[model samples]
Target chain A: MTTGEPGACVLGVDSGGSGLRAALVVPRELRRPDPVRSPEPVRTGPRGIDAAHFMAQLLPMARGLLEKAGGGHITAVAVGAAGLATLGDDLRAELPSALAKALGVRRTALAADAVTAYAGALGDRPGAVVAAGTGMIAIGTDLTAWHRADGWGHLLGDCGGGAWIGRAGLEAAMRAHDGRRGGSRALLARAEAVFGPPAGLPGQLYPRTDRPAVLASFAPDVAACAADDPVADGILRAAARHIAEAAAAVCPSTETSADTSADTCEVAFTGGLFRLGEPLLAPLREEVAAQLPHARPVPAAGDPLDGALHIAAEIAAGRLRLPLDSRMLSVHGEGVTS
Target chain B: MTTGEPGACVLGVDSGGSGLRAALVVPRELRRPDPVRSPEPVRTGPRGIDAAHFMAQLLPMARGLLEKAGGGHITAVAVGAAGLATLGDDLRAELPSALAKALGVRRTALAADAVTAYAGALGDRPGAVVAAGTGMIAIGTDLTAWHRADGWGHLLGDCGGGAWIGRAGLEAAMRAHDGRRGGSRALLARAEAVFGPPAGLPGQLYPRTDRPAVLASFAPDVAACAADDPVADGILRAAARHIAEAAAAVCPSTETSADTSADTCEVAFTGGLFRLGEPLLAPLREEVAAQLPHARPVPAAGDPLDGALHIAAEIAAGRLRLPLDSRMLSVHGEGVTS
Candidate 1:
């Protein structure tokens, strides 16, 4: 079952509101230096939900990945899901159990989607990390502990998350429709181009099932418009400020020594939002840096899937611990087949 | 009908989104320094709309006032409305001519609710004022010039307006209902208290006919909660700041003299909101004063209706002029009356 290897193997999956990602690994090495079996990325969803629904999508995704991998060597599975807070502990526990039932395997663990993303970016390090995915959330650790601020979904806050960008883009489009905005031909054209034949735009956005992806698709156009458009720039600046606030909120509440460079922490980027490169990230980085001058933006080594696998390995090796360090993650995925 | 006297008489009516108030006025020199006419306060339901409805209410009220006056002559009629804005010439042209028609008179004039209040307070002097009535708005003006900001209505801005207070209070109630905030008993009790033996509290609030009044009733409770309730204080403070912003927007633009009293151009308070006295007004007045030292707050001259009448006299005298000074609002009202 173990591929005749002495070390243990466990799988980790980060099921987000937008997509599901899977990572498989050997407990002794968590680093994903190779692309083979290290942390294979697979995009699946109809999004995640409160714990019960999270487990539902997750278990099937895990089983499919396990089936494809020839199953025998897996010791445990860990799932990271979005909306875990809303579900509270009751549903979280039930979800882990539900996953085991669905996969016909008894071993499983669960944590916040944010925690996993933090693990991916910081490798269990204490510094804070925000997952600006379809929804934005900030999670951090002061080495001894962790805290979160403003991840209350789209209706409440999310801030610099993908959904916000998408919503902003859509609003810009609507403003164009109503002739309130000065000009947005580029945005209009992009929307028209997306809803080919043009007539279906309303149905696609208002009623169609693919609204999230459809909206997410608009983020790029918004980024493109940001430099040339004042309105777009305003929106991006606001988003960046919001995310920076989130990061600041989660950071340790204390004053440190004068050597800020050493005292400052990394503000890692993970999720589709970071892909916009500097157009979006630069402002966000600037905002966070303005507040926490010592903090620097570090690109995620890979993504949350990698961190999930790294964490899974830690658990298998009996080295599972909180305040995971970046060094542990750096080496954890090296031996896994990418 | 002149009663063989050089003294003038003016009728001032204050109309809001929901009600109408008419005041019979005898200018300061003609009677006791206080200008209010006893009894017959001039009221009408939901008659804040057209000339016809207004006439229906006004004729009776006017007749009663005249009858009470032992057949004194009427010199001029001045009217001020809450919802009406001084929308420059273009928007003003679009306003229904029915307003003049409703008063059932050859002379009719209109002015901003804020201006009316300003005139009532400063009597054609140059200064600024922050009015938080059913909704919040701030307007300031030098005698011949004016500036305004943030009266974008309930959904857009309103800020410290009564409606804003009510909405914040409602939100607090909802938070308490959902267990997000504890001990909102005062808000709930106040809400229930206002609805009266209202076929029950919920019944009165939900009944289509009573919803507007029921909702309006919450604004006072919001202020009441501010003294001790954190949630209530948060709402009031935010609103106060919003109102302050509105006042600040006009401060630089206002006209004033170097030797004028320090509080001259500083923001002043009027409207029902100030009736809550210092608790609410102090913070609002301070915030605005902090921003614009000259942003003074003066007590209103009884009501905007007085200002309206004052303006009506000036208009009848052919003193109608452009860029009317808000201080001489009575003069402004008179100038526009014809």
Candidate 2:
């Protein structure tokens, strides 16, 4: 509690379908008004680490980060994992202790990646955050309640995510091959450049073990072709509309809201899809505005790593107030209510 | 070649994602006005049999059927298999000889399931056939040209198929769980009845080896709830529209066609989705009419097995005028030009 005293450090991990990243930082560094520039992570790799082996996969990454921070006293360790939503309440409750023990930290926090993303984007404020990477979900809080929409996964949902865009691109490529409308020649060329002949697509797609990543890899091509390709542009617009709908779905209805602040909900966007910049953000903002006229577009104050570190700092000071169902555990594996 | 010979027999096989069926019949019996009543198949099992192992799986079934037919001189063996479209021309060409050797037949024919479905539905007449089972595709022949649309697979296409409906139902279930709109209480209840709890859906869906089958199992519930459930009704209507679109996409345009038959293209619907009957068919007819006014809905004249037998008979009589690329082979493995 000495406000980032020497050797007082915290570890934050953001693990998703696309990649795993862990950052170690002093708590005081997160107090700035602007977004915290995340320290270079000690370990990073392509994601889709199985939920069953999440703790096992994460422990080493946390350990590596702690080691890199030079034998410091870890105040807290926080993990925001993509598949965390699938874990039941009991499993979620058990995770804090497991993470505490694995990281050799006095305190630990675990949450769905969307929760951390919301916190990272809006901090302690009440608003909505739409995170679209390999998958997509929208999480929002109206101070009293939390709402979530979509992020179901590639097969069932994740409609506006990077993987979804990539899939749409691939479908357009195939349609072009069949001389169907709604396909772009540029998109087909881009796909052929990456995966060779379009005929080889099934070989590359069907039998591959890491299908999410393979599909998501096509997203960049979709973004790159958005300037001139109608198919790619259409895919992007549809994705933006979906993301906007997701945000509107999670945000409290303005008509029924008793809170005066609810008239204008702050909405923030994050994730790899946004890296396409205005090609994504412009349509996203427009659609969000169209759907929720009172939606005020705000740049995400930070990324999930920053959110994790902020939670870690708050947990260390016993000041964390999360609307999410979260538990903290001490090094001795005893639950600590925040 | 013999006509109505005592020993003249043809084997017809219909292999789809759900099951495989084989029947042996004399060619003369198939020339009846009514559809041939296929004899009980000797082998049946779940589909998704690999292309590489297609012969391995089919041989036993064909042999069993041949034995059941009681030592008749096998004239031809024709197979309509799911996933056949994904196989290359060379592999498809090779299938004729492979089947001929395995069945001790003089002629063999191999086609995508939709092709046989079309042949079965209209009996070589100029028209389109929309097949929506575990997957969906439309194959149409104007007698001079062949057209195909959709049936890309569960991931990229198959928009109106059982898998698609099942996926939509699951999404609605998840939406209901998240307290979002567009979820039917009945749909959720039906889903929980089969899969236990909604919370376990992602676990059941993501890691499963037979995802398509699992997804398809939900289609019946969607059909059952169509009358009372808005979500179910919407799903069914959308499916019908997609199926209609696919049919229209594959049919020849009336304006440009030199043949007057193009002005009134006959459209036949087949597969498990149609088993829902009017709840599925009514909207399908409406959508087809909306998309292609000249489209005429026709009851299927026969099943895929009958279509295979028809082809076999034609091959034996040297009267088959198939628009498709087909090859015949004798037991000695020499390619016999059609």
Candidate 3:
């Protein structure tokens, strides 16, 4: 896994829903550098991801990281970005050349954040990674091709994600306020305390551009109330089922025969949603076990930045093998063939 | 409700999700005028409804309607607007004065579209009206006060509404595409036919300002597939149950005591969603029958435009009996008192 010339460095960046972060790594030395972080996330526009805004935040951080690594020869750059599959056309079209010119790098990889998450969690191994943060997506690979499920953004999908859980909790709260069936008084009190009167929630929410994040902010409150509230617990259980379903959908089948019941697969859960603790995890664990009985659940070895670094190092070493999707993952410059 | 002076009229406008509609009513003769409609919906902004945008569309339409009515004296104007309950501050403060100054009106009544739909369906009678178009809401009164359930917009509640049903159908389609549980092949085929590749639906839908309407537009497709698809049937059934729940929540109690189920509230259905016909209404009928056995279901008497006209005529007649909530239903100028 460690392949680079002595005194050589590579850049890794993760531009995601929450923020932008970059790290510099000397792959030959096998030491992971601390990521330089920015609270600001890259902007999106009519064409999807704004390339100029991404570069504005990234170039400076990439430069600072390189300098902090003691002026090493920067050999490669890899970026894992949110919205990269559907919204990364502009980034893919421009970023490789942009980085090559600005940072004097010869190798670069542009990847969907999900792909990087897969790399981070399982490190090029054949497996599925369910990354649940402000949004949720499940990604998998059988070594030759990639598979994905449920990352269709907040409006169309992203079921079982943080926003989904928060929105479900809020719906139950509003239902209670209206005296409808399937309501919870605990969730209602929590919603009122967190977002004011239930009547005002629509006004507070519908107009916002950043609605997913705003919705996700309440997921913790939902988790907090899950222990005592059947409604809250139900919401989490439904979310857990969705998560496991997504995992099972993307997990590679291991049956050597068509009719075989036995199989083997690697499954891992990663990201901010796992931080909700046992109220969410206990049910998630049960659902995953029930739905993906043949798959083994494992811990994520690293974050997306680490995945970015892994891809960069692998590209530098001529050993990257996680498949090259035009939209999901692409290699550029001298590293295009390997 | 015929009390306007001879050669005098009242203006009625409905600014809703789909369009802007206005009518000039001759209450003295009890004649219903043909409505003038603009396809453009009023714009909303940070401060809620754009008063200037609303006035720009309304003033000219009002003046023209008045002129077409033989240059009649416009005594009052009643506007039934979407978002009026929550986003009508600018409209409430500025609309009355603007209409008064421009038209020399003495009376005005402004109401939420739900209220107008109620007025249109039952004509200020003691009953419940369920308005279901792109959004759904249940409103009821026992001749004393107003109660509402589930008009929380596309992102929140709007349970059993067109958007909700459409969203559920699309979710199933996506599940099918992803090879997840609860997937429906019929819905997948319908979704692919209507929206093209399932993978690109998020790009097609998420960026639009008219997301709810866009989602609602697919409701018929779901309905079309319901007869042959259990998934679609399940979605419709769930939606019907939600509709009944909302109706029951808002329906006024007629129980003489706490233990009696002998309620006599009349319930009526109105709006675009009902046009889905038996696929939706068939189950909705069963659900209403099961949930509100004592409540009677009645056919809608008129549309929201008719409701607006009725409100205007009632205001001119000085006989509007619907309770005057400051937000839900408001009376201005000379008609402030019954």
User: How does each model score on lDDT?
Assistant: 0.56, 0.71, 0.86
Instruction: For each candidate, give the interface RMSD after superposing the true interface residues on Cα.
Output: 10.3, 2.5, 0.8
Winning model by lDDT: 3
Residue A250's C-alpha lDDT in candidate 1? 68
Worst 10 residues of 3 chain B by lDDT: B254-263
Write one digit per residue (lDDT tens) for candidate 2, span A172-263.
88777655556678988988899988756875687777787788889989999998887898899998888887888888666654465556
TM-score of chain B of each: 0.71, 0.83, 0.94
- Per-candidate TM-scores read 0.49, 0.83, 0.94
**CA deviation > 4 Å runs, candidate 3:** A27-30, A43-56, A256-263, B27-31, B43-47, B50-56, B256-263, B335-338
Candidate 2, residues B284-312: lDDT per residue as tens digits?
87898898788888898888877776667
Compose the digit string of candidate 1's lDDT tens values, residues B91-164: 13422243334433334456767777766676656666767676666666654466665554442345577766
Fraction of true inter-chain Cα contacts (below 8 Å) kept per model?
A: 0.00, 0.38, 0.71
lDDT of 2 at B16: 61
After the best TM-score superposition of candidate 1, give how far the Cα of residue A35 lies from its true spot, in angstroms: 15
lDDT of 3 by residue, A1-338 (tens): 45457767888889976688888886445668678887688888867788888888888887787677777767888899888878887887787788878778889899999998999999987879999988889988877778899998787778999999999989999999998998889999999998998899997898688999889999999999988899999999999999999999999887532223426788989999999999999999999889999899999999898999989888888788798888889999983763
Question: Model 2 chain B — which ten-residue stretch has the worst lDDT?
Answer: B326-335
Best by DockQ: 3
Q: What is the lDDT of candidate 3?
A: 0.86
